[model samples]
Target: RLAARSGLSVGRLKISVVTTAKYLIPSLLGEFCQAYPNIEPEFQIGNRAEIIQRLKQNLDDLYVFSNPPRELDITTDFLTKNPLVVIAKQGHPLKDKKSILWEELYGERLLMRENGSGTRYAIEAFFKENRIKMQNPITIASNEAIKESVMAGLGIAIISQHALNHMAPGNLIELPVHGFPIPNSWYWVLPKGKHVSNAAMAFREHVTQGLSHKKPNEHA
Candidate 1:
């Protein structure tokens, strides 16, 4: 009953989506827009710094990201927990292995995200903490590009499992690694102590319901 009434109003709501272009650019945003056709979604695809700056300037109504700052004057809600996985070509020698160790990646050519990318930061931190020596053979900015490069046999990379659905058939293979599996949280942030617009609130509820309705028996 509420779902049909939520997005009917044409209140102009401005949303600033922060995060990688992989998830938001088409998938999430496309569905969100379909639910609330009147509300406009603006995206600022960059590192965390850009999103923080936008929030500081009151330029955004909401922030969609993997992580939000601890001290920001924002209300937050947990959205999803995404796990990190290593990826290579399907026929790559590593695919046959049950599991790979951090040390096993040493000297392997890697296609990596640039500095300031959250995924790259998390993976690098994991490697540093475990004292793993990894080779950075190439660096790119977008997940799509990195996935394509890895599929082309340019190098292997660590990426979110959620993004694997977008990769090619028998092209990029996700490798299960022992002592690895970087889990990260995705969140929604809104201004603290301020009333969120009806349109924005509706969008939030729509997304929440959508996620909540995902059945265990269904394929993602």
Candidate 2:
């Protein structure tokens, strides 16, 4: 068949990812495409809930997540570390502080991702464990919006370090809050018992080999 003749070098590669992975997956995908110029990539970016819904429906060849859903019977490969850190506007009072306590955050306005976001879930669990109660936290849907709000002095937020990599210099700074960088990682998921296309297999190998060469923090 023509499909066999074209091989992995020419085919549709479908991938879906959580919004935070938007800052990371595109460039790697671009490199993959460069090596196989004839291949077409169908990339979808959504919040954790949306991506999970897509996964449930088996809509994509691969799915990327910082917080992989535990309820799903899927296979996950650890792609890279995605450390979540607290962030604030460049000139905030706590900017120069050291070993900031978790209780100190209680007095500050917390900016949160919308309902069903993986980042929000992780933050809420951490806060619950630490017995810190947020006061009327604001909910922003996208990472870009959250960063913008922080830059405008709206409030501090907890987000992946990868999100800050794409931001312009000198606009935002990570707060050295204790028990921070919530220890997260990106995962590549596949539905159980699903057939793996050659294109998908190739991409998985490309990502694994590519990321292996860089330091944990340099995955971006």
Candidate 3:
């Protein structure tokens, strides 16, 4: 409270976020820093499992992810949409189609993220809902790597739209999967009952104010 009341001398925060939000979250943090120029901010970028470990140790003021894990005793505020989309190399047979059925995807060799990735979970959940079984999927290391494999014509994959930054000119294209653009949102999560710092509290308010009206989950 003294640091916040002092209003410019000392404010610091620690934050950990999942990998896919690397580009967007940093920009938001930069905006927050402009108001508290001296705020010492620390960041860790990792996958979902790494983030869960960090949260267990209470490492950061906030944790961010697309799919919220229920195991954590945290309070989450929806920040923004993290829509998922299917992508394939340019000139793939489905490129010109506007709305391809999900069942149609079964015919194509699919590229997938590593076993523990959030994208993989999202993909699995979608398949499970429709009782669709995924055959052997080419396992890539990261979203960027998946894009690379797709560009090489390995197969198509679903990923957060933000990671589309990894695409090179005309190398890959978005395929219109019916009932796709999965309606998921990024959330700012803080463990309840933990000691919240003024800087951390301020940052929470900074983000929450913009999203107070959004529902916790998105739907079709």
Models ranked on TM-score: 2, 3, 1
Off by over 4 Å in 1: 5-9, 21-37, 167-169, 215-220
Summarize candidate 1's per-residue lDDT along 57-125 as a digit string, tens digits: 887666766667668778788766656778888787777888887667776788887776777877887
Per-residue lDDT value at 74 in model 3: 81
Best by lDDT: 2
Higher-scoring candidate on TM-score, 1 or 3: 3
Over 4 Å off in model 2, which ranges?
1-6, 215-217
| Residue 85 shift from truth in candidate 3, angstroms | 0.7
- Local accuracy of candidate 2 as per-residue lDDT tens digits, 1-220: 0112235656688999998888777767767777767779899999899999999999999999988998999989888888889999998887788889867777778889999999888888877888777677899998888899999989899998889767546789999988887888899998889888888887787777667765755764
In model 3, the clashing pairs are none
| Top candidate when judged by TM-score against the true structure | 2
* Candidate 1 C-alpha error for residue 95, in Å: 1.0
lDDT score for residue 167 of model 3: 34
Model 3: how far residue 56 lies from native, Å: 0.6
**Distance (Å) between predicted and true CA of 101, model 1?**
0.7
Error (Å) of candidate 1 at residue 71 is: 4.5
